[model samples]
Target chain A: MLTFKVKRRIIYLGIFCFTLFLCFFYVIKTLNQSLLYFKTPSEIFDDQNLDLSKEIRLGGMVKKNSIKVNKREIQFIITDLKKEILVSYKGTVPNLFLEEKGVIAEGKLKDKKFFIANRVLAKHDENYKPPSENQLDKK
Target chain B: MMRNLFSLNKIYIFSEKTLTFIKSVFPVLLILGLTFALVLSPPDYLQGDVVRIMYVHVPSAWIALGTFSTLTVLSIINFIFKIKILEIVNLCIAPIGLLFTCLAIITGSIWAEPTWGTWWAWDARLTSMIVLMFFYVMIIYSQKHIKPKNRSLMFTSIISIIGAINIPIIKYSVEWWNTLHQPASIKITGETSIHSSMLMPLMLMLLILLLYSALIFLMKYKTEIIKVKRSGVKRL
Candidate 1:
């Protein structure tokens, strides 16, 4: 007959191994999904086979003077140093969303050159402040 | 052996001291941290008043991560050395750590809506933190189910060791992956990317939260000890 302690030890080991397996499986799945969810303008440009209909995130810096605010929609260009893709977003934009800053737009691409963003997110660097007020005025 | 590790009389004195500390120091620090965080801090040039959320959000995140790391180390020590006091310390910290983890997620979500334009995303950093919370829940649950003193400790220790692997993943997730969450501003290299103005309130809040967690853990630890003693048991 198996001792009580041995049986308990066996149960503990089983639970530990099971949980560890599940944790790793979940981690791997998340890592794979992240790669698919995140893409730069250049990556989308390079990947011709990427689905245009599905919603995706395109991250890049907003090009200077690319913003055009109209009555219904706001349009801009997202550039990843090497390539640029035009994006048009409707509804209110984030407060921090500005020109010459990093941004991520989530939407569907109409074609290789144009992206229709449903939601636009402004990305800022780690720096808390944008230099002094007068310094910005000097610029 | 457990009796020697946590004598009843010593626990009485320690709990009394902890209560006094909580009553005296905790309130002062809480008020100061809140004043600096909510009122004194300047609004962000870009985020404006929404930056106030960072005062709570950042500290909660730091404590959540810090508590988990502390729990993992204590678990390893308890497992290898078979120390009962270490196990009690480990158990006492889990609930507090879980609370901070939940706070971090809630605050982050609130901050995200206005800042990131989304309440939640399955990005690398956010998902990893959710996973860490799940791990904490599982560890807390297993403590109740596993029978036998040593067996429970072994299981909890193993679970914690496994979960510790996620801590590093959470820290580096923003850097390693392109996620909605931003990279860390305060690094250990003493080279902060944020301005001194914002960093001051943030640091004060962080220190206050750390102190608050210590106060909470001390109270919980004393309660655990009293409960164990009342039950006339040497091990929990």
Candidate 2:
């Protein structure tokens, strides 16, 4: 027979384990239910059930040579390689927003082909490198 | 073996020696880390000098996550084995964890304005970090205001265990969801994308911060021990 202290310890351990399992279950369930922070251009195009009227964030790389500056308004095409959506915004873009750079635009989708963004955020990759000589010269 | 190693008398003696050692080494490390971080580290190709904020931001976030994980484990052991020392340790750690979490969030916000064009967003990563902060606050609050020492310990353990669930979510949030926050650059298992020049400074800063944390923990632990002794608490 186990001592009282050992028994109590075992009981506490059992309770901790049970609580941990419950927490894990809750986290998994919640994470599974629409926790997406942003939708890519391809995801928006493929999903027929996506509500276009509700404002959502569209994230992808800005297509090369697709940026057009018409006065204060900026137009660019965001592409996930498989699909692309035209994004139009009338404000200042972040310094990092450049051709082929990752970006997230928060707005309502006008249609499958166009997104009207109120805010455009530059999303950089994890990679970090020193500027090359030519790029440093340009700076 | 573990019990003997963690006994109050042994820990008290150990803390004294560790404190002296840390005090001496801390200044040297601080100078070295600052020089490497601010001067030696190369500017980023894209973000330029603004990327230097990462030296502080990443380390703070890492320590915040690490402290909470440590607290949760200690709380579990304390709850199961009824170790009084672990309770003291958990109590001291909670505030430090909260401070670092706040530091991480602030530094990240400062960094975000220049890079992401927004001060804040309800992204998965950012939201989960905020939740972690709330957990720390809850633990600290309960520890202070809860009546009956045993009940306080129980509440802290339970809250910490529940909060532990958020840890994994914070780490994987970038991958599991498309967040404005970038994915991890430094990985334990895989190849790191950060170049060695930047990586060196980052590591130096992390080491300095970790040393600072150790120094603070030892000082706090010593004070708690003294307080318990003065109160004539026989549990220790």
Candidate 3:
């Protein structure tokens, strides 16, 4: 039969375990933040504390003639209203990885000031896709 | 007798049980706390009102790693102790962990598009999260197809433990390579670390997220237990 001492030990032990998991969980929760989560090419280079494991989003135009593809890796340039940034990828190119298209690459930013993309999503012109030749008449 | 062997009331009688409860409730409370920080806590001088999103975005990212850490530690513990609860906990944690990881990626992107002038960057954290997302998918996929009774828990626990490699990958993601995001905050030790004002909200949000995680863990654990209990019964 289980004695009171045994049961008490179990209770105390459970509480101790709970506290420990909470503490470790808290450490990750509280401390893992950054001054910034996104970066333009200029900002990527400007900030000195950049890291590799962190997740980031890089946005810009797919510079014409700048894109280079080999196997799964693709490299291109992104530009804002002001400056240009270089980006590299080593995965299936998102369908919209075309020149002059607005693209957002999801991947890592390197210390080299270049971004290594893993996925890409293209932006369509806000003007909206033209209706199929017949859809215009459906209205 | 077996039901009474480790009953609900008996949960208080086991250290593992207590750990389970705390693990379950932590995430929910953390999420609520994040909401508070976002609405009530101080805002960033530069980002203003919108800055509040950072509180949620950052901690969600934080917990994504932490949740996976649970998988890692519990999996290791599972290997060492062969406890049933650890496997249950790991299964329950995966869905929420993946959700938070996805949330972090999405929210971070929204924040970046404006502030950084781009929608995405191949930063250290960003890449790892994508990896984290893949891990989450594989874990969930494995859990679904694997035999429920055939040492799957042990195998999954091992998977969870091994998956822990991502945490370090995430932690050092910024350090090992060059990316656009900054380094650790509460855990960092550099001369130019996060300011207290930022830290205050971050802390509050983190507490909320911790609570939130526990809440999530418990909710899922309870449901899983119920599923287990029903597994053997046939209803006519």
Candidate 4:
């Protein structure tokens, strides 16, 4: 048998943990929808009731050989491998914006197929490696 | 028996000895860490030398997260047991965690600009980190400004326990959301994506920061002990 004080402490701990669990449950229930920072092309296509007027973020890889550059605007296809959306932007892109690389475009949708982006950000993978000899020579 | 083993007098004496040892070792390790991070580590194939920021950025983030987790655990224990030493430990740790959290945010902004083309974003990971900083500020503010010592302790402990909810949210934010921040490269289990060459300097920097935190914690703990004694606290 445990002492009374130890038993009381255990009761306190149990109460504390249960309160924490309740808080976690409440946050998950209420904040789940707002917590998604961006939506992918596939998600946009799958959802028909998404608001079109509000500014939203579209994130995916820049599809290979889908880039079209003009003097003032640039256009490219953003894809999640299952679906694709055309993104048009007038602002300058980040240094990491390249074909077959991850990119996030922030703007509103023109339709189900095209997005008008006011900002573009490049997303790189976690892997870090030094430039190979030929790539270094190109620089 | 447990109380006697962790009595304030014993902790004070232990801190004095440890502080001297830490003071001697910190500068040497800091120099070695800087050399390895700046000169020895290879530049990234894509970002080049800008990748060096990870040495400072990643460790600060890790320390900030680790300190908050520790504070939350200790706060919970102190709340249940009313341990005086644990109170002092929490007091010393909150400020250090705040400093590192700020450092991580600033360094992350600097890293974000060149690579991501933006200095800030409302992404889940970044937003969650900002929320953590606010929680730290709230805890520190309550500790400093609240009246009636017992009431202050209760408030701080409650805030810390509530703030503990954000810790898991911050860690898993990148994975759970479509955020600009990439997922973790280093894992406790399974294979790590980061190369060994860069990993060495990162580990060294982590060691240096850990030592620095230890040094600060010991000093703060010693001062708190002295303050308690001067106030004629006979419980010790």
lDDT (tens digit, per residue) of candidate 4 on B211-236: 99999999888888888898886764
lDDT: worst 10-residue window of model 1 chain B: B76-85
Candidate 1: segments with Cα more than 4 A from true spot: A1-33, A130-139, B1-12, B233-236
Instruction: List candidate 4 segments past 4 Å from native.
Output: A133-139, B233-236
| Model 4: residue A16 alpha-carbon error in angstroms | 3.9
State iRMS for model 2. Answer: 1.8
Q: In candidate 3, what are the lDDT values of residues B64-169, reduced to their tens digit?
A: 9888887777766555545676677778888989999999999988876544445776556787789889888888877878777546665665456546656786
TM-score of candidate 4 to 2 decimals: 0.94
* Higher-scoring candidate on TM-score, 2 or 4: 4
Candidates' lDDT values, in order? 0.82, 0.90, 0.66, 0.90
Q: A1-139, model 3: which lDDT tens digit per residue?
A: 7667666655754675577656756754664554233455666656687777887767666777888878767788987646777887776654435788677677887754577777666642312111242255467
Pairs of residues clashing in candidate 1: none
Off by over 4 Å in 2: A1-12, A15-33, A133-139, B1-4, B233-236
Q: TM-scores, in order shown?
A: 0.86, 0.93, 0.55, 0.94
**Judged by DockQ cut-offs, is candidate 4 incorrect, acceptable, medium or high?**
medium
Which 10-residue span in candidate 2 chain A carries the lowest summed lDDT? A129-138
User: How many clashing residue pairs appear in each of the predictions shown?
Assistant: 0, 0, 54, 0
Please give, for every candidate in the order listed, the TM-score of chain B alone compared with the true chain B: 0.91, 0.96, 0.78, 0.97
State in Å the error of residue B196, model 1. 1.3
Local distance difference test, candidate 2: 0.90
Expressed as tens digits, the lDDT of each residue in A1-139 for candidate 2 is 6568878887877886797788787867777646777898888877989788899989999999999999879999999999999999999999999999999999999999999999999999998878874376679
Ranking by TM-score: 4, 2, 1, 3
Candidate 3 reference-contact recovery: 0.01
